[model samples]
Target: MTKLSLKSKVDFIFIIIIGIFAILVYSTRNQSQLARDSRMIVHHTSSINTVLEKILSSTIDLETGSRGYTITGNENYLEVYNQGHKNLEIWLDSLRAMNELNRGQVLKLDTLERLIESKKQISALTIKTRKESGMDAAAAITKAGRGKEIMDSIRKSVAAYQNQSVKLLSANLNQSEVHVKSRNWNFTLFAICTFAILFFAYLQIRKNTERLILEKIIQTNLMTELTVQNQQLNDFANITIHDLRSPAGNITSLVATMEQDSTLEEYKVIFSMLRKVAQNLNESLNQLIEVLHLKKNKIIQQELLVFQDCYSRTIESLQGEILKSNALIKADFSQINSIMYSKIYLESIFQNLISNALKYRDPNRRPEITIHTEITKQTILLHVSDNGLGIDMSKNGSKLFGMKQIFHNHPEAKGIGLFIVKTQIENMKGRISVQS
Candidate 1:
């Protein structure tokens, strides 16, 4: 039956679209990871090359400074020699920190290090000989050609390390290119499939437009009937509450008089129980009357209310409770300061929300409440948030605004505040939602 329906066909197409979207997302993520790895390889290779070049430059500087000082016997040449040594040590340490090198690459690096150390020792020996021994001694050591051989060896080792790094980089880049080409082809195919499905779905949606128009007419008629029925239900509730009010009041009066006249302790206890029951019944009837009045009125008064004024009035009314709980209240009405709404309902909303925040605050921390206003294209939104014993949404979320539904085990929780707030907002064609 579902297969035969046009809407079902459209839904199936949409489901396919979602599947394709998921595949595309996965492909994109994989491509991103591969690209990231390639970048890391390139960066690592660049760092190694930079360190190698620095080591070669420092080796040359050490050789130059030693030779220059041996010939001229100048003290300034020692500064360059000392600086070259410091730079070489730093650059080598940096290269060694790069542990991603393979065994072959690490071996090449070790050979380079050995040659650099030999060159450094030779340069230091020449400098010390020139300083302590005569110029002849230092010149004799330089002329022996061992320092030249060590420098040549260092250069060759550097070239080998550089060649190995370039080879590895080229291999990695080639592999990445292959993967990229495959992924690009697959993505192109998926894109073509997505376009074809969307085009087909668009045609199917055009065909369903007339059916939607007819359904809208039927829905309008059904809404009319629902409105009439709702009015009738409201009337019935009004009559029921009116009939029950007198009986509830009578029960309360009788219980009170009986309790006062009772002599026996057991009878007094029984009368007290009856009194409590009667009082609860009376309170329930009163709350019901208030709700029925809202339904009957249909159109309550609306006025332009300034948010700051309303907020201040509510705060003033609850000044005692706020001080007692050490609540820090904040308000921001900068977006839209005024709105056309019922004054009583707006004030009641502020009062109930703030009272709950202060009442159910976390005892370990001082209470902090934030009230703010936001404006969308067509609606003004009021938000109230607090640091308190939050509702257990998993257990009590559905029944949060239901009549007489209490979540926290507080003595003063009548459970009617949220119910009344929700009713008021909905009565004015507004809405309310909560997050824990």
Candidate 2:
């Protein structure tokens, strides 16, 4: 994966981490708020119970005052009755306000109100009868027990209100317990998930480190093996140059000697063929030695050499071929005048390109080769193009620069030229491309 994509994925994970934190914070807040609401419900329910008790107490006080006034005909007792009646109204009003949301409690409070009003009226009537119609009338009303009946009704209604309030308080307490349990569970789950994520991250990091270390070890061993193989290759190349080229040189000498005395007309073609084969074999060996020499010499010998000068030398080497083909050559190195390169390799590269272009020229058309250069901050680019019998790249793309991989139907197409050029360029830490 790319660094940017990995970074993005890491950022996404952090976002998820942050999101989890937010959810925890939000849930914690909700849990706390729920707890507070539960406490408030308890407090309000108690307040309501207190108010109902006060109402009942005030009603009893009213009843006691009425009884005293009726029995002893005391004006001071009527003042107590008046005080209790005022307190009863105030407490009932508070209870009604507190229980407004509870429809059943409101109805019970309404009934309590009516019962209190009726008891008050009956006590007042009994007291007024004691004042106006004397003890006989008041005592008769008491004997009938009408005021006691009204007081009993008031007490029953108050009890009903108290029972309902108790039920609500009990329900609120149960809900508070449920909220407490839920919040605990939520915290527990959050802890578990966080631990799991951290554990997984640790495992992945350790695994990746181990894998990377293993890969580095393998790469080190491969590089060491490659170095040994490359040294052996150079040694074999040196051996071939000494042992094989000496015999080729001897063959060339024999051919030259035989040619000097040749008189048989029919055997002339055979001698010429043998001479050509000896030269071709010697040339291939020399090219191989050059390639292996480059591979063995790991140290770069660089110089600031003019590209135009190199191309001129290459043309000079191919002077005979150019004349034979009547080829036209063009050079434009103005864009990039010079390069830091090895003189021998650079010259060989140009010579091979020019020679191949000429060698592969179409019989129906005159050969034209163009050489140019471009300069960038990083690289010096050289381009060589030709109007010749071009190879079909699509058909032989993979093998284009492979050894002994010929493409064209040319008598002298060895196919090792492009491979050598590619090796030389790459040895210099440069890359090459083919368009056709």
Candidate 3:
């Protein structure tokens, strides 16, 4: 398991907790708003009820006062009548103001207002007749069917207003309950979603940790394989160089001994062939030895190497062959001064490239080689180019620097020169590429 730092773990947990708290706060606020709406609805309903009750009581008081006046002709009945009329007027005004605040109550309040007006008109007519005519006449007017009909109509209107108020209150209550329930469920779902997201983030962190470990293990295994391969290559080169050195030494000694005598023509020819073979073998062995040395170490045995000096030295090594092939060699090292490099490796790379150019020259054209160097901020680039027989792109382009790979079917081609060149450059923490 990969252990997270305390701060990071705390931050992750803090974010999850904060997220859940935010959701809960939002849900609580919504529920609070719904509760406020429900309370307001209840208050409005109570207010409407109070107004209706006042109106009903005022109508009842007017009927009683009119009856009292018809029977006794007392001034107290008129006073009671006036008080009830004032109360009714106040209640109707209050109801109208409430209806303005609550649009849904407007129609019911209008109907109630009309009923109160009709009741007021009938009570006024009764009062007027009672004051002018005698008690019997006023009593007769009070018992008339018109006044009773108006009272009945007022009762019917109040009943309708009361029924409508009850229905509206029930609807508001039901809607408020539904809103509360939905808020509760939404809070629960939000918490569940936050937990799932946190869990998924945890799983992803664990997976990434495991992936990093696996990649590290893979890189270690690759490094081990490369080490083993390098060791095997070095051992092979060492053995080959050791075996060839003995015969090369013997042939050089034999050639000196034969030159001491006036040799016969056949003997001279044999000695010359042996000397040429020995020289080629020595050159091949030296190349193998240089490759082996480079594989065993990283930093080269650096020595001051002047570009012009190294160029001349390489030219001298290939002088006889260059002359035989009539090859043209050009050099431009103006941008470079004396630099440090391993002498043997540098000589080998230069010798192989120049000699290859000569060996692979086109039969119909003269061999031309150009050697130059360019210096950049981070590295130096050395380019060795030739206008000889260009490489065959279709056949051997990809395997140009592969071990024991040859592009041309030349008798002297050993196929290891470019491979050694690439290895040496890599060992020195540089890179090499060829384009032909």
Tens digits of lDDT, candidate 1, 1-436: 3345786887898799788879877987887698669757855775576567667667766765776687668878787788888988988888877843477776777887888888888888998899899788998898898987897788778778877876766666665665555565556566567657756765866643554345446645655655564444433333333333332333333333432224445343433343343333333334444544554575577889999987875665554466467789999999999999877668667867887898789999999999999999879999999999999889999999886688888986767678767877986899999999
- Per-residue error for 97 in candidate 1, Å, reads 0.5
lDDT of 2 at 236: 38
Kindly list the per-residue Cα lDDT of model 2 for residues 166-214, writing each as its tens digit: 6776677677666655665665566556555555545644434454345
TM-score for every candidate vs. truth? 0.45, 0.44, 0.43
Clashes of each: 0, 0, 0
lDDT of 3 by residue, 1-436 (tens): 9988856875886698787778777887877798779758755765675577567657766765665566567778777678779989898888888778667678767877777787788888878887887766766776566776777678678768867876776677666656655665655565456556556655655533454345456645655665565455443443343333333333334333432133345343443444344444445545544544554463357788887876765665454466567888988999885677876667666767787788788889888899999999958889999987778666777888877787777876777777767766775678998776
- Model 2: worst 10 consecutive residues (lDDT sum): 240-249
Task: Give candidate 3 misplaced runs (Cα > 4 Å).
Answer: 1-10, 101-104, 190-436
Maximum-lDDT candidate:
1
* CA displacement after TM-score superposition, residue 22 of candidate 2 (Å): 1.2
